[model samples]
Target: MGVSIVDVAAQANVSTATVSRALRGLPRVSESTRAKVLATAQSLGYVASPSASGLASGRTRTVGVLVPFLDRWYFGHVIEGMDQVLRDNGYNLLLFSLGGYRHGKMRRFTESMVRKQIDALVVLTLGLSAEELRQLHRTDIPLLSVGGPVEGCSGVYIDDGAAATAAVEHLIALGHRRIGYLRAGIQDEKNFEVPALRTIAFETALAKAGLELRPAWCMVGDFTVAEGQRAAARIFDAPGEQPTAIFSGSDEMALGLIFEAQRRGIRIPAQLSVVGIDDHEFSASAGLTTVGQKPLEHGKTAAGMLLAELGGTPHSLRETLMPFELMVRDTTAPPPR
Candidate 1:
């Protein structure tokens, strides 16, 4: 045999258990003894088995991340942020997708697939119900949520309602009284819907400013570019009581609205002003005014919180709100007389 933990222990004049503990860098092992064991292990070319170490210590040094949808831009940015932070802290990520059915979500989570595999859990934009949360708590894994606040879980979230308020208020400040609100269609009504929050905020702001919240001005639909074009057509089809400003729930939808308006020979800001949430990658180049929330930072913060829980530091379980900024670009302005 080449070299083993036994050989390393013999060379270092320490117990095999001491050699094992030192190599794994587990707690309760003295620094001096660890240094000696590491030096001896290196000299003997002894490599510890990762699987055996994990099995013996009952720690996988991994975290489980559950997201509602992976294709969305915000979620992608959050995943990138979490990936970087987890790697920096010497932990691996195990991702789970809770797709389609509630039963499926429960089965996938409760099944042995992820059993004893992850030290902590982080859920992105998926608000867990009391029963679902209780089921998760049965795992005894620390949990965190992002995008929206959860009842009992430690979370990193943005004030999405407030961001929408800021975007609408900006357009109102530009003297655009006839405002239209575009929202996303509700897919998962039980989890969380941002458009509902945005709509409420938009209406609240308008009512606070003593402006009428018209039925004709409110439109709810998908976030697709095609939906944007369709909504724009519907809004401009009739000449009675036209809106001078539009507040879109997403940057992608805003872009579609902008292009559709241009096709109709409507001049942005001068003829029709537009405001959007999510300062997307092309928002600046497209000159789209938007509310900026750091999706990547949300991811990193959630990851950090999970790691802290895993390490037994026990951080606060309160909802942590990340900051938001307003990016005023060429898309919004005062309407013409």
Candidate 2:
């Protein structure tokens, strides 16, 4: 038989309850006692079973992470940050990807999640409906959100409106009057509040600058390189005067547009200036101007908040807006005379 908590407690000269508290890092346990228990447990190869711990204390020692797409760069980076914190705290992660399926995925997932014993839940960028939110609330678990805000829940995310406005303002400052706005098209039922907010910010910034937002200049493309290339093609093929600059909603799209423009023999920054958001890994190497937000930091902050709540620490349920910076690289310059 494997070494057990009883062995650890006996070796540490403490009661089993004391051993359990020390292993769980509970506050009532003294520092010396905790250290002694940990050392004794380690020496005996004692590994506490999560199920046994959950039976003793109502916590599962596991966190459930719900994300729209695990393959995407933003979600992947955020998850990495959360995973680090959870691992350091001796907790496990249960990932639920809500990407596929035609319908009923969110409903089924939320309903089934209530039966699972997770200490907390972390939602990343997937909007929940009123019924779904109500169901989650019924679970009475510590909840956190990243990448966008959820009503009645604490979250950490960047101000999508401000970031997009900053990108647009940078182009306007460079004397580009006819600027195009390339945004992601609404593809699914998921609440894409980020793109919607960014679009509003783009229009508002243009209005503030006393510049007309041409109907033809507003293009919708999926947040991807291929979509950006296709949108560029459409913009250039139109009969009206082409925009001297373009503000894309994502770095991937911006890079795609730049590649397509170069293929068409259009000089970047000289003939067609471009800007994008996200400051993706390739943004710096490709010399793309963009508004950069830290996805990894957002993840860590959200996870910390959830952990605090779970640990009985006082925390506010308000939305935490992260910071963003404008990276002016070789892609932007003063409009041609």
Cα lDDT tens digits, model 1, 191-296, are 5656667778998999999988776766655665678777777777756888999998888788888888999999998999999898888788999999988899
Name model 1 segments beyond 4 Å from true: 1-52, 100-113, 188-190
Alpha carbon deviation, residue 117, candidate 2 (Å):
3.2
Pairs in steric clash, model 1: none
Per residue, candidate 2 scores C-alpha lDDT tens digits across 202-254 of: 99999999999987877788778988898888888889688999999989889
Best by lDDT: 2
The lDDT of each candidate is 0.76, 0.80
| lDDT for 131 (candidate 1) | 67
Superposed by TM-score, candidate 2 places the C-alpha of residue 86 at a distance from the truth, in angstroms, of 1.0
